[model samples]
Target chain A: MSVLLTPDQTAFLQGTLSMNVGAVGRDGWPCVCRAQGLVVARDRRSLTVLLSASRGRAVLESLDAGSAITLVASRPATHATLQLKAARAARVGVSAAHHAASARCVAAFGAELETLGYAAGLSATLAGVLPTDDLVALRFAPDIVFDQTPGPDAGRVLAHT
Target chain B: MNISLESLRPCLDGAIPAVVATASPDGTPNVAYASQVHYVDSEHVALSFQFFSKTRENVLAHPYAQVQVIEPKSFRHFRLKVHYLRTETSGPLFEYMKAQLAGIAARSGMAKVFALRGADVYRVLDIENVDPRLLPAPAPPDALLKLRRTFAHLGACDDLTRLADRALAALAHGFGIRHALLALLDETGGALYTLASLGYSASGVGAEVALGEGLIGVAAREAIPVRINYHTGDYTYHAALYVADPASPRIPLPVLADPHSQIAVPLTHGEYLVGVLYAESEENAFFSHADEDALVVYGRHLAALIVQLAALPDDAEPALAAPAPAPSGAPLAVRYFAHDHSVFVDNDYLIKGVAGSILWTLLNEHAASGRRDFCNRELRRDPRLPLPDFGDNLETRLILLARRLAERCPQIALEKTGRGRFRLELARPLQLNAG
Candidate 1:
């Protein structure tokens, strides 16, 4: 069975949400890195998120072909969280489309933080957005998704791809 | 592994929440936001396990997790590799985190949503700074030097009143803490009364807070330190319990309109809780873990000194003051209520409980005879006043009575003449009544 993200979930992933990527290394140790932006594919089953090359070096080193990967997208002010897990992932070079999407996402994230009472330029700096040349994208097809909101229904599965 | 958790203490302030990464036994990775990455020690940390999420499940299965914390001031990030130890459902650390989370929840208007279930203790396996570009952190004030000076000042005090004043003064001068108060617990009344304070327009010396009412009360009741780094109305003592009525005898607790940081540390002598020491700031996150530690040590020192000074033997003979002629004025009405032993001066609410009872007794003794001096032995043996048998804080009560009189009814005073004796000083004639 193939799990597809609902329209609302896809919109949420592509919206001005803070993203973080998690990957497990060969030693079974997991690493985390902040994501600048993400772009959902048309199929709604796969997505690619831009990670800063220097900041996300730990997670990038942990990434391997067919290794497990997880990305959590959260709306900061609301604490609305969604987690997507895939059994496989691959690190790829930044594309022109990824670069443009990264800029748009970072700007939108900064605006969202501004509305949440963060000082100007502080929100953007906290997001850790980097030049597109220093960003790497990880593409994966999420097979498991969880509504990770901070309440009783947090771990409930929304879909299983 | 090259990094130490001590240097990364700022990152655990919860000013910026941490993101936790965990991997299941089956190799599936999980990531989520942990609201608090509590720094337990140099090799340990704790996370609030409020919800049964994927991260919790993965940790239970695999035991290994990675946490990334950001220092709000510098925007610097650090990654900590930790191994899951055991979850503590109740303890000092759990209470500390629960108190902190309550403030966070209240600020976000999610008080009902977030509840701390357990403190998941973790052993730090390694720590690494993810960012190479770092801002130079400002050198913190010398906490050890401050504590040393504070103790030195407290060591010179010989009485509870002097001890309380010196303690507050030490906090102001040494720790740079401007807003602070020292309150002693009235065990029989299940309340705490403010004896001394600093940095407020009003001294609020006689203000009382019921047990479990606010940070100070809760700290005394639970015998644990309670600290909130942000302003939260949910725990505001004045709003929580104090409702001043014109007819009632009450002193409103001193409050900051909008305090961003507040902490209350329980002052205990061994197992007995003696009182609470509290401090606040208008600036957010002003009190850190090190400050809390210093305050705890300072509170214990102050409590021990108070007990030691209170136990000193009295002078061999009671020194009596020569009866001075009373001033020519209208008789001041002194009313005492038996229900709560509350005293009112000229129909104005003055004080209540043991202090009030002591005042009533002193006034009666003065009216019956021209006696001006009293001894602790007579008060301790007095059957009319309610005092504990084992650890009767009579000396402290006299001190409280003296301070309350100084604040409310300046015409009446209680002056310590010796270790166990005190003289009742009056500037005007008094008419005593029992209501």
Candidate 2:
């Protein structure tokens, strides 16, 4: 059974917030970096996130290992978080339409950071700017979704609706 | 420049979640976030193993790991190369981490979840300062220097009062702590009474909190330190956590509105619990890991002073002296709320509990024998007032009663004439009513 993203989860993914991805490669060294160029597929069956070519080397290697990984998208204002446990990942080219969404995502996430008590310019700084070259999108099918909000429901496995 | 793991402690306190990376035996690398990287020693740190299956598997199988931690106050980051050690399910470190996790969990509304499976202790192999900004270091409350200075000044205190004042002054100057309170453990073995407090509207001079009650109680009960940082969370919910928690004390313990940070350190000498040192602030994350470390060291100095002073002989003359004649006035009515032992003088609220009973008892004795002077020994032995088992808060109760009387009920007052002895100065005759 494939779990579809709930309306709330869909809203979270589309909202302005920095996304982080975690993975362990075949060699077993774990790595994580700020993920940009986030896109939730229209059907909510999968997610596509882009890692910069220049800064996401370890992250790309982890994805290349094809090991299970976690994608966490969180709003800084309320610490509300959602974790996606993805089983498979593949690299894809960035589309022009999706490229514009990436800029909008950073701007929105920056607004959330400001609401969370960050200084005026910190949001822009904390949001990792997408690199121009080798900006690869990771298309992964989420096996399970976990509510990663900073509370009891955090990490709770959500049923596929 | 290289750094010892301990020097990077402030960064590891878990305020800012740390990211950990580990490689499998086959050289496959993994990365995940950790809630806290607890400092075990200069050579080790304990990472919480809750449910990160991959990270756990990698560490157990490979032994090599790296964690990147950021200092919350100053956003400096440090990377620690560590090797996996044994996992501890139970012990001092585990329990301490459990308490800390509880605070963090409770603050984040995850107290019901985030179970502590084990404390995975890791031996630090190397530490690297990720950024070597050549800037003047931020002042850290000068913990080491202030601790040394506090110890020297504490050594000069000849009495408990002086010792307490010096302790508060030391924390203020050394730790940059703005608000602090020192409460001596009552003889009842179950309550702590306010003796000295700074940074409150009222000194909360005579306020009392039972053992195992609130933050103060938890620290005293476990003989451990409890610290928390919250942007917004009502501490009042603590009572709901405990079924039989007494209704919020009428005289509320001094605390800031929306207290962003709080800490309570238990003071003990050998097996005897001396008192508790509590500090709070309106600023978020006001106290850091280094502050906790500094205070724990200075707490030893306080424990020694408290024990030494308690063992020292009383220097004041015995009480039983007839007080100056009572000035004439309308008979003021003293009402005692037996339910909570709250006392009100002529409808004006005064002290309560053992403190209230003590005042009522003193006035009772005055009406009967015309004697105004009383001593700690007499109050401790008084049968009319119910002091809890081993309740040695007499001297402090007298201090509370005297201060309350002096503040609210000016007509009838109690003043300390010497150590353990005080004279009741009655400006108006009083009628005691038992409620």
What DockQ, between 0 and 1, does each candidate earn?
A: 0.66, 0.22
lDDT of 2 by residue, B234-282 (tens): 3432311321225734555665655667778888788788878988877
Residue B368 error for model 1, in Å? 1.3
- Compute the DockQ of candidate 2: 0.22
In angstroms, how far off is B99's CA in candidate 1? 0.4
List the candidate 1 regions with Cα displacement exceeding 4 Å. A1-7, A103-133, B107-109, B145-155, B187-190, B210-213, B236-250, B270-272
Residue B427, candidate 1: how far off, in angstroms?
3.5
Please give each candidate's TM-score. 0.89, 0.74
Query: What does the TM-score come to for chain B in model 2?
Result: 0.81
Residue-wise C-alpha lDDT for candidate 1, range B19-66, written one tens digit per residue: 999998888888998878888989999999898877889999999999
lDDT per residue as tens, model 1, A1-161: 44688899999998888789999888898889888889988988788888888888778877753458889999877888899988777877788999899888877877786776555676557545344568898888888889988778988898895
Which candidate should be chosen as best, given TM-score against the real structure? Answer: 1
